[model samples]
Target: MVFLSYLFVLPVTLLVAEVALLTGATTLAGVSAVITFGLGLITVPIAAVAQGYHRAPDALSPTTAVVWHLTSQLWDVGDRIALEQRRCRLRSCMQRSDQPFALPRRAVFVFTADPADAHVRGNVTRSRARYLYRLDISDTYGQVFQRGIAVAIAGNVHATVSARRTLTATDVPTP
Candidate 1:
């Protein structure tokens, strides 16, 4: 969105402004009309691009990105906790040799997105798409803890994270 906006808006805005200024429109109404026309010219293409972006298959929705980012943070914290646990275990072992500690193995997280229900129709913003996501974070010992997550994206700007009770599985569907 950032790249597209800059590419389309900046050059077009500059060109339109220059054209408006250079073209003889000295009268008040004429200047206002020119300004309006330039604004329309700038707005139309941007709106079209934005609409296209939202509908594009390659585009990543804000909600999905937020969910992924939150899950990644959880994974990082889990790794740190697992490392500390490993260190504690090593200390208990009482290895007297002057050797560097081996790093604990990292567990891979499997993220899946469930399909949205077609029959359940709701509000445009407050839709049925909002639901609890089951996130499984595995420790170094291969024990998986389920964390229930509820993600709400308002206006595609604000994301609310509500961590509820744990579940047995994990996944999120693309918007």
Candidate 2:
């Protein structure tokens, strides 16, 4: 978060230094400003790349890819903005549902699960086993929209389907 704040703050600092230099500031101060600006120029891109690299591994996950794709398709706002703002979260838990199996959405498979695990169940003994997952995208001011998903695991195979999507009341525009 500090790095992100630095990205926004550095430019304004540079602008202030430029103005001071033009207004007959001391040469020492001017030199210091130039050095600071030069360091910022080198560090900004490095910070940006490091931030991106942190998220890159998660982007390769099938679940993350499907969530992003679905957000682009079903969400009213731009997915890129949500992604760039880091407002998306993926959460999962083992659960049971009586709903019948539906066709899996394209590329929604995450991974196989063990059927014998009492906690996971995995739909092997009975078709009621499912993994419940939620994808949440929040607006700049903290209002959140959420999508619920169910991944049914049968033996070593698993498939995911959207269960529901909900927008927070604050997302509705005021009259």
Q: What is the lDDT of candidate 1?
A: 0.31
Identify the candidate with maximal TM-score. Answer: 2
Error of 1 at 73 (Å): 2.2
> Against the true structure, what is each candidate's TM-score?
0.21, 0.30
- Model 2 residue pairs with clashes: none
List the global CA lDDT of all models. Answer: 0.31, 0.33
Candidate 2 positional error at 137, Å = 19
Q: Which candidate ranks first by lDDT, i.e. highest?
A: 2
As a whole number from 0 to 100, the lDDT of residue 156 in candidate 1 is 16
Candidate 2 — which residues are off by over 4 angstroms?
Answer: 1-26, 54-161, 170-175
TM-score of 2: 0.30
